[model samples]
Target: MSATIKYDDVETGQQIPAADYPVRRVNLVMYAGASGDFNPIHWNERFAKTVGLPDVIAHGMYTMAQGGRFVTDWAGDPGAVVDYSVRFSSMVVVPDDDEGATITVSGVIDQKLEDKRVLVMLTARSGDSRVLSRARAVVQLA
Candidate 1:
């Protein structure tokens, strides 16, 4: 087990450093194929435009999963997340390029909870938009 992060050591207003998450076209396709979410809006730019979206959009769940990965990496275990939620604030446009779209995720410890838990207010931004709003997670420190 990794060293436990003590809840008492964290400050309420401390901002967690932003972490970059790379989402390539292939990654989106794989996520679609794996998750069986073959929404045309996710892969077909023409369809996305027809629906009034700026460009091909990524799956909301895909973005959420990426955020989950970020939190898990910090906690050193996926199971360490006690709760997590987010509101879709904006769509993540995925262009067909090598750099892909990078989602920058950051968080702040909003409050300390009993029993080594803390409420973390999260932010997920891509390009100039806030993709995940009202985002928060309850993480259990080991």
Candidate 2:
């Protein structure tokens, strides 16, 4: 499907509405199963502490996927995203509780490029920690 957002209608520096994704221990377990990462730090709090982490952390790729979801959801089509990348800046600690942790994602249109594409800059934060840095996506618009 084509993107609902047209390149001609978009402006640089426009803000996308922020979205929050909650990460729970069970979600981490499911992600580990699906991804085959199965790393202790991602699922085992004691093991993670033994390894010098504050608590069980979410997988880096899972965190990146949330940022991608934010971009694709805004673009209105997953296929609209032609390129995406991010730098892992901090860990998302998932506590074994009902609230768990939250990853808040927001984006801004950084530049309008040729070929109906735009450069989007993304920010993902969990509490006071900046979970992603240098996050960007190139999306093809209608």
Error of 2 at 26 (Å): 1.1
For model 2, residues 54-106, the per-residue Cα lDDT tens digits are: 99999999999999988888888888889999999999999988999999999
How many residue pairs in model 2 have overlapping backbones?
Answer: 0
TM-scores for all candidates: the values are 0.92, 0.96
Q: Which pairs clash inside model 1?
A: none
What is every candidate's alpha-carbon RMSD to the true fold? 1.7, 1.6
- Using alpha carbons, what is the TM-score of model 2? 0.96
Clash pairs (backbone) in predicted model 2 = none
lDDT of 1: 0.86
lDDT tens per residue, model 1, 27-129: 8889999999998989888998999998888899999987887777766776889999999999889988888798999989898888889888989999999
Task: Go through the candidates in order and give the clash count of each.
Answer: 0, 0
Q: Candidate 1: which stretches are off by over 4 Å?
A: 1-4
